[model samples]
Target: MNEELLKMLNAINSKKEEAKKLVMEDKIEEAKTAKDELIKLQNKFDIAKDLFDQQEKSKDEEIKNKVKKLTVEDEEKKGHNAFVNVFTAGVLKKAVNEEDVKIYNQMTEADPTEGVSDGGLTVPQDIRTQVKELRRSLDALEPFINVEPVTTLSGSRVIEVNADQVPFDNVDEAAQFPDVDTPKFKNISYKVVKKGGILKVTRELLQDSAENILSYLTNWIGKKARVTRNFLILNELDSSFGGDKTKTLNNFDSFKDIFNVVLDPSIAISSSVLTNQDGFNWLDKQKDSDGKYILQPNPVNATQKLLFGRYPVAVVSNKVLKSAVEGAPEAPTGYKYPFYMGDLKEAITIFDRESLSIEFSNEAGDLWGKDLTGAKVRERLDIKTIDTEAVVKGEVSVTV
Candidate 1:
């Protein structure tokens, strides 16, 4: 636009210079003609300038409107309205005025699926965020299990697994085989169990302090489920398949024996380790020839705690992997720290039938009379040992 305007100005200056030259030559008629041409050029330039100015003004107005729309003040106003709609209008059923109540009632009527009277509001996104943030209080045990979602609550799933191949001598191609060997498989049955807790809260707290109450209860229930399931898995491994591929370590030097057992060619070596903090601290002190710690960060994935840079290690709480007296049958005196190392997912499989679900009700049997609301959260999951040989469990004496 500026270039076009410059061209017009240059044309006008050229016409004026021509007019002056004509006047100096005493050609009055030609000079007057040049002046008229200059006037016409000036008029065109003025029209173009006016159009450019109008275009610039419109562009400035558009930019100002966009900036106003995107301002933090506008966003804050929207947030305030959202908060009011969720908390006051929806949950508490309150209205700032008659106009807001009408709007809120209309919104409620439009979406019949919201609120406890309906199927229960999808547990507000903000409340869910609070739940997740609080869930970090529990120990991180998600990596130990390969979770799968299933629609059926109870059913049997067929799993085809490769067994250790039998050894055979070389035979001629034309010779008939003695016997055929095929891979073995077993049926894995899954059943969902209802695991949850009911929390009673006063009406005042529900209306005024929903966030804090939800966070606390969700954390409590989550911890219970996680800790309970983790221990069940560890206990089942010890009770049901303890004697399979066992390795009892008497000294720190023999720690490699457990690793070798897991990494043995006969079984899958892609594994993780689970032990109490005491066991982890013991392994943490083990040094190489260069006097460096053996428990180094995993090279493949930096987030994992690798043992000898080979296997990921998860520190189960002492409550689950408890210290017990384990020696020879004749003399069971020394304190033994239990450790599990192997293909964790293959060894102990967790079958989840449903995700964690929560519901709130103000009208329960006793809660209604007591004027309290009940928040209940539950999940469906069960654990079973899939392949005993895939994992190896051992105990190390703390005295050693």
Candidate 2:
């Protein structure tokens, strides 16, 4: 509502400035002409006396005058900064990784042992200081050092589905392998059409130099890189979290933006494991008579270290669905929903066979972006992937 008014006010302000400049430079004739234009504009604006008067009042006066803020938003806006442009029209596209958790704590029939201490990796402060000093001393030769910045991800259980009891030599190769009945793989495959996952990155656990170093690191890379990607993080094989100097070793306990998740595999799995162990440090060891390791596992609750950039979401909006049902006499006689808005980016769109629809890459480059507002926008990535199977037959159905 204030858009039109703002345009007028900005023009008035520009003209006033121009008039002041012209008069100061001794351009009397030009200044007079500009002043005349300003006067005319002011006169035109004066017709809306109620709006102009309302805008002239200070915020405090306006607030005291009105008890209900929302009901009198026009008055409230007048009291607030008029130059603000809230970018509410921006679109959100997020990706996430879905993981199937295997029960690692399941009893595999092992013997109970009276153990006071399990050899855990605990680097002493003095040793850490010594190593840090050594690094500082060798700063000149640091670049030449062939340090291994390797990551070993763990606990990614085989991707499985309950639909059919299909045997697999390897779940990773299932897509390439033939179905039991199809003898030879007849190019029959299921592309990841919809995926819903989330990584909630948080900054809830940091202290001292740890905090200082973390702060420095975040300032260097966090907002700058602003890069996102798909990866299987293989850094869980060692106690030292992967040697990515750009990232953290212990955890993501320094960021406050929760709900934004890091869709990395290693970080997700390792974080999940550590989360399960947090409550166990409080438990005292015990003995069991049945000769079984009756480890009283603590109540495990993970805060889902929010780095999962976004709660990956996928939604079959009207636009998307219309595109999905294109070309057929029936509008999507059937639709398979494997994801919600939270399921986006689980499986990247290897191919978008749907025409006039857009798909975005990590760099924010969009394909088929110009026609995004049309009815061809699909809600399902699967429907967007196959050209032969899915077709758009009808023209866009939009109502004004």
State the lDDT of candidate 1 residue by residue for 288-400, as single tens digits: 78898888987777766787666788886776577676576567656777787777777677676645545656677898798776766666777777776677778777653
The CA root-mean-square deviation of candidate 1, after full C-alpha superposition on the true structure, stands at 9.3
| lDDT, candidates in the order shown | 0.66, 0.28
Query: How far is 43's C-alpha from truth in model 1 (Å)?
Result: 27
Which pairs clash in model 1?
none
| TM-score, model 2 to reference | 0.14
Which candidate should be chosen as best, given TM-score against the real structure? 1
TM-score of each: 0.60, 0.14
lDDT of 2: 0.28
- Give the lDDT of residue 25 in candidate 1: 100
| Maximum-lDDT candidate | 1
TM-score, candidate 1, is 0.60
Question: How well is each residue in 1-400 modelled by candidate 2, as lDDT tens digits?
Answer: 3666678778899999999999999999999999999999887776665576676666657777776666576533321211011000111121111110011001111122111012111112232233334332311111111122112211112223321334444446446754453222223233323222211212221122333433332332222111110111011111122123122212223111111243233222322111112112211122346653333333342432122332211112232122223244454353211111111122212222211111222222242343221111111122111111111111112111
